[model samples]
Target: MPKLETRLTRTFNLQYPILSAPMAFAAGGRLAAAVSRKGGLGIIGGGYGDPAWLEEQFALAQGVPVGVGFITWSLRKSPSMLTDVLKHRPVAVMLSFGDPRPFVDEIRAAGARIICQCQNMGHIMDAADIGADVIVAQGSEAGGHGAVRGTMTLVPEAADYIRATAPDSILVAAGGIADGRGLAAALMLGAEGVLMGTRFWASSDSLVHDGHRAALLEADGDGTIRTQVADIARQIAWPIEFTARIRQNAFTRRWHGHEDALRKEAATVGPIYRKGFAEGDAEQTGVFFGEAAGLIHSIESVDTLIEQINQQALDCLAGPATRLTSDRP
Candidate 1:
């Protein structure tokens, strides 16, 4: 099999050029550690700087070179958590949903590469300014918060800009990439690797609610919608330009385009939303996933998913002529 060798693999010292996205409340220590143990880098979701949660997940990711990702705007409020995260000496410190500039120097001093997840081309320049080792070009199709650009155009565009300005910077593609074909396509688009979230969110090791996982399996690409309904219902103060792609449910339908209405009804809706999450009520809550939800038909182990992606990429790269004719001879 061809090694998934690239700047990503070399930088993280991973066998497969994959990063298990640190999806908040979804990817915890077990999932991250599992991916890391199996040759890919695993990233714990340190969403909003929950100290106790972060501590528990870090403990669970004991043996692996686990990294941690944070929503930058949220992380700013709890800067001490960054120090706590670095104490573990992760392979990389991933930041998304806001500016990563303030944390770059501290992350480097702690001996971890900076992985800046950018939702727009403008953010890519900000990351480069901070000398980020890796820039994850996350398009609008991604499950979580993202900007308007699509992955197809944005990945290569960012790659070209980075190559011209920061030759040593590595580029990774995110958003809507879930399978082997996606991985292969990313490489061809000038990215050295991929940041996987939705696919891994349905994995066995993921901390996702069982109800959410079941619903995700039933959902296709069309089943998801990009909107701020969930954020509004849950009262998360996300950036105005970024929207989350989540599986359609009653909650989304009830408040889809009515952001103002949701806000007006926050007192009543917020409690219900929190209850739905606590109870795993699919109808009452939305499941965060991407357009790649179409590619995910079954819930499998991370090991199985990673191996499948690796094999698929190898086959795709080899082509039928090399795969079939060589075996015949």
Candidate 2:
């Protein structure tokens, strides 16, 4: 057995330590089910806690043991929404971008594991205080709404923090993790596994447009830019401290520097944004991706991508240090 397989076989209840990050709009039933069926943990991005959309995706899952993830602060608006989702009995409840303390009891009472996504040590400690079963350290390289800390530093920092204070807690690294190299590096950085978004968003199962997937396949890391204007235009209020990483297009280029103006124009631009999504225009719509876009060459099936990553990780782990040379002996 390869060392990677041995090390990553059961990081959690998952057969593979790989996890598909809950990307709103892009990651839906097909993507989540595909990853879950392929031995990794899949999570439906319950973005803003839309019960209808979540219910539709749950039906689409068709018996796949998947969980649901939500934007924490957004869920705060409707506290009862959590209770509603809990009725479905998700494997876990993933909360990000806010204090997770308020809903911990409800999630626990429902017999669901709690996975908290954090941007820094402060939030990680807070999640630990809330008794999170798993803590996901989402670095700045991630797509969607994210903080400004880079993955290279955040993973190890989080790992060290947990080891010293809450050694029992499991840590997963997010942001810019696309390939086996990234996975191997994350493990080396002391993460038990990785939460991948950009890589999977380019996969065939993802709900994103073919043109968007194609663009992701061709884009290098430098092609992505982080901005808050898109969310503002959509009236998706996010904390000022966090920004969304998206493909830099004409719309982003125009508004990235002028958030106030974008807010003023949001009423008119909101419909335009939705229309752009329908029309598949990059300039008008937004495509989310992290720095890992540089590693994407083509969009493959979710299972194939998982296998490729797993094999690469195995090869990396079973290197010279673990190899036993029978011929030399």
Candidate 3:
């Protein structure tokens, strides 16, 4: 039982240096409250800015120090959505996948800390300039929409930049960190904590459908493909440069690189896709996950999972670096 104290845990008044990602549709009130109850920060996903869903989750959190997140660009479509969320006085607000400038001032004025997730140097610099309290270096290994940069390289780069520039801003690592080993490695890489999406997405408290969870359990890293296929097929208005990571099911295998084909046939395929999602057809719907899916074998409670990872990380940080260095002697 080693103490894993870092600026992040202290800054956020958390017992552990872990933060559950606000994954849209997957992370809800139960998941967020469960994580918060276990001493880790829980952020509810307000993905794509659904005011009703966001309000419902906030209420469900029931006075927990629960945070809320939004896809920055999508929130632009519904500007007042931020105000709606802000009135709740969330513990924190996370903005990702677009310019955070638009809402930075308001968030700061609201007296709540802001967490900005960035994929590249430019994005991070912008977050720093905006005075983000926590900067998450999200790699492409993360589920859902992401930018160019692997977690390994991006974490250190962001850490270095933060130290050099925004010394007060905390650095967090994201993408493919589903276990304790990854947590220890992130600490070594200069990050104060890790923002986990895929791991928490598979937790029992998560809102994942049984069918989608089945798909997630059956799949691994290779089982997912990063593409705008879902956006096109489901007719989501995502940015051209952005893409989502979803499990490779029959639907995706049928049209992996054929975006144009999916677009042309969206009229016919769209209904089926929507229906599959609605009916919980695992094969036809998108199951969002990251490369870390390969590392997750079972769905456990937030307390069990967070404690397991924390103790594992403590062991690694104290015992040896062998877990991170190599496999064979």
Q: What is the overall TM-score of model 3 with all chains considered together?
A: 0.96
Candidate 2 clash pair list: none
- What TM-score does each of the candidates earn? 0.96, 0.93, 0.96
The TM-score of candidate 2 is: 0.93
Candidate 1 lDDT by residue in tens digits, 1-329? 56779988987889999998989999899999999999999999998778988989989988588999999999998899999889889888999988898898899999998999997889999988888898999988889778789999999999999999988889999999888878888999999999999989989899888988888878878998889888888888888888888888888888898889889998889898888887778888768888888888888899988998988787777777444211111
At residue 159, candidate 3 shows an lDDT of 91
TM-score of model 1 (CA atoms): 0.96
Alpha-carbon RMSD of each model: 3.2, 4.4, 2.3
Two-way lDDT contest, 2 vs 3, winner: 3
Please provide, for model 2 over 1-329, each residue's C-alpha lDDT reduced to its tens digit, 9 standing for 90 to 100. 23343233454456678889989988898898899898888889988778888888988998788888988999999887789878888888899999898899999999998999999888999987876888999999998789888899999999888888887678899999888777878998999888999989989898888878877776788988989877988898788888889998888888888989988989999999988876667777777888888888878899889888877776666686452211111
Write down the lDDT of every candidate, Cα atoms only.
0.88, 0.84, 0.88
Clashes of 2: 0
Clashes of each: 0, 0, 0
